[model samples]
Target: MKLRIVHQTVYRYDRPVRNLVQSLRLTPSVFEGQRAHDWVIEVGGGIRGPGFRDGAGDWIEGWTVRGPTEEVTVAVTGRIETRDTAGVLRGHRELIHPLAYGRGTAATRADAALRELAASVTEAADSLDLAHRLSAAVSDAIAYAPGRTEFHTTAAEALAQGEGVCQDHAHALISVARLRGLPARYVSGYLQAAAAGEAHEAAHAWAEIHVDRLGWVGFDPANRCCPDERYVRLGSGLDASDAAPIRGIAAGQGAETLDVAVNVEDVERLQTQSQSQTQS
Candidate 1:
């Protein structure tokens, strides 16, 4: 399947800021599951700086805006061809050891609850089976209820609340996976909604666990499935904040308001529209 995506974020400040700097992990990942085409990232009135691939094999680009300005916009547009590899990340080059992801972050730190949840799934046949069981345990533990959690909500907090969005689900799964001696990380990306008017966030997240033989396998407990062709993997980190597609700071002390819009469409739909226009 082929997908086209547009993601835009606008920032409005109460007072003009001196300057802004951003690190972007907005580029799609290159693995056997997906290939990107015609990808572009633009920051209005900003200068593009050095870009590099990190040890985790994620593309990072820097942008600087010398703003005495009140607003800034970051826009991304792209197309990608994807295939289902059954959630296994294949042919992706990375230097970091899988064990490195075992380290916990503030958002994914395990608590007694998380440890118990991890221990609840103990009858798996192998590491892969255990990973799947852990994900299912997380899904059963946390109900998917949007607006029930906040950006800084930790895994333990979300579990106690028993309701959260995809971010919370990913964090909780990561926490419990680590408790089970499995290496896990958070993944940020886009998911094409299954049907028209479906209530799903185009900007989505999930968790990936490393099995002994299979390097990294993704699991989306909120949706209760593994990632398939409908998903686009951007980057991965210990937690959401670390894997954020956009991370930036303004120099001046002005409160900022943010608005974000994301759209993902099938390339076949786009082609049909183009053909109709040509006929007209």
Candidate 2:
């Protein structure tokens, strides 16, 4: 499947900021499951700086806006050809050891509840089955409720509340998986909605666990399935904040507000429509 994506983020400040600097991990991952084409990242009125691939094989680029300005916009446009790999990450080069992901983050730290949840899935046949069971446990533990949690909500908190969005689901799964001694990390990406009017966050997240021989495999407990061709993997980190597509800071202390819009379209569907129109 081929997909076209447009993601835009706008920042508005109550007062003008002195300057702004950003680190972007917005580029799509290069793996057997997906290939990117004509990808572009633009920052309005900003200068692009050095870029490098990190140990985790994620591309990071720096941008700066020498602003005494009140507004900044970051826009991304791209097309990707994707395959269904059954959520297995294949042919992706990375230097980080799987054990590194075992380290916990503030957002993914396991609490007693998480530990118990992880222990509840004790009857798996193998590590892969165990990982799947852990994800299912998390799915049953948390309900997907947007606006019920904030960015800083931890895995423990979300589990206790029993409701949150994709990020919370990913975090909670990561926490419990770690408790089960599985090396897990957070994955940030885009998901094409299942139906035209389906309620799903285009900007989505999931968890990946390392199996002994399989490397890393993704699991999205929020959706109760493995990621497929409809998903576009951008980057991974210990948790959401670390895996954020864009992380930036303004020099001045001006209050800031933000708005984000994301759209993912099936290029094949659009082309089919065009061909049908021509025949008509």
Candidate 3:
């Protein structure tokens, strides 16, 4: 299957920014079962009119503009070809290694609750059926709720509270997997539209656990299923902070207003016959 994606983020400040810098992870990743024909990060760099990536790879760019600049807009656009793998990640060449992910900062070590959860998820890795079963168990154990968490919340906090969005779901699953020594990475991406008549947000978060036999396979405890063609991977890292679509600092002081808009429209797209074979 092939997909075209465009994601945009805008910042509007009541006061003009003297300077700013940002790191972006907005480009869709070519991994595990995806390829990019043309992926570019188009930026309105305040004073600079436009900037873009010439090809596919980790990309970074920024700007320092004079004050009196009240708005900054960033957009990522590209055409990508993706397919569903046979529930396995193939090939030795990969950029999604665990050690390579994240803010490159030391993460606070996992606690006892997370350690126990990891044991539970890894205990049933004898077969695909067992893995799926474990995933379902997580789903049954947690509830999805918004506004129940903040940026500093931990897996145990969310689990004890029994509610969270995909971010919490990811932290819970990652904590469990990491405790078992399985290399898991946080995936930030946009899913194809949700089920018919469903009111859904435009983005989703999940985890990919690396197994001895099956390279890297995705598990979405929130939805109780493996990632299919509907999933378009953007970036992966140790946690959500590392793979956030945008992270930055603004020089302005007054309360700033920010708005983000994301649309990943692939309506009427059906899975391809060979989706089961393609794997990055």
Candidate 4:
């Protein structure tokens, strides 16, 4: 299937900021499931710095806005060809060892509740089955409630509350996976639409566990399934903040508000084979 995407983020400040700098992980991943045809990231009134691909295979670019300005917008437009890989991350190049993901960051640290959640999983035939069980466990533990948690809410906190959006689900799953002695990480990406007609304000988040013989496999506990062709992976890290598509700071203090819009649509319905693929 061919997909066209447009993602735009606008930041409005109460007062003009002195300067702004941002690191972007907006580019799509290079893997067997997807290929980028045309892609671009544009920042209004900003200068582009040198960019590079990190060891984790994510492209990072720096942008600086010499602002005494009150508003800044980052826009991304792209087209990509994607296929279903059954949530297996194949052909992705990265130097970081899977064991390295076992280390938990502040956002994914397992607390008593998270440990209990991990312990609740029954033994499975294999690690892959265990991974699926873990995913289902998380889905059952947390109800999908948007606006119930903030961006900085930790996995433990979300589990305590028993409700949150995709980020919380990702973090909670990562924490539980780590508690079970499996390597897991958070993934940031774009989904063609919300699952089950639920409303969403931004992109999407999911968890990836390294299963024996399967390498890295993704699971969307929020959606209760593995990522299929509708998902476009951007980057991965120990948790959401670490894999944030955009991270930045303003040189001077200024109250800020953010708005984001993302659209992913199938663009190749004309071809017979493509129509069948899209229908799937």
TM-score of each: 0.95, 0.97, 0.77, 0.94
Show the lowest summed lDDT stretch of 10 residues, model 4: 193-202
Best by TM-score: 2
Answer with 1 or 3, whichever has the higher lDDT.
1
Q: How much does candidate 4 score in TM-score?
A: 0.94
- Pairs clashing within candidate 3: 32-280, 118-176
What are the per-residue Cα lDDT tens digits for candidate 2 across 227-270? 99989999999999999999998888789898999999889999
Error of 1 at 58 (Å): 0.4
Question: Model 3: per-residue lDDT, tens digit, 1-280?
Answer: 6676777777888777866777666666645577776777765755432334423233435544455578878877777766777435544245445434322222324666656554665456454545565556567667877778875676677777878777777777766665555566677887765434253455788877766667677888877777777677776667777767677786778467766676665533434434544642
Summed over model 3, clashes come to: 2
Q: Compared with the true structure, what per-residue lDDT tens digits does model 1 show for residues 119-232?
A: 889889998999999999999999988788989999999999899989999999999889889999999999986323363545999999999888799999988889999899
Order candidates by TM-score, high to low: 2, 1, 4, 3
Compute the lDDT of residue 223 as modeled in candidate 4. Answer: 92
**lDDT tens digits, residue span 81-157, model 4:** 88999999999999999999999899998888999999999868899999999999999999999899999999999
For all candidates, the clash counts are 0, 0, 2, 0
lDDT of candidate model 1 versus the reference: 0.92
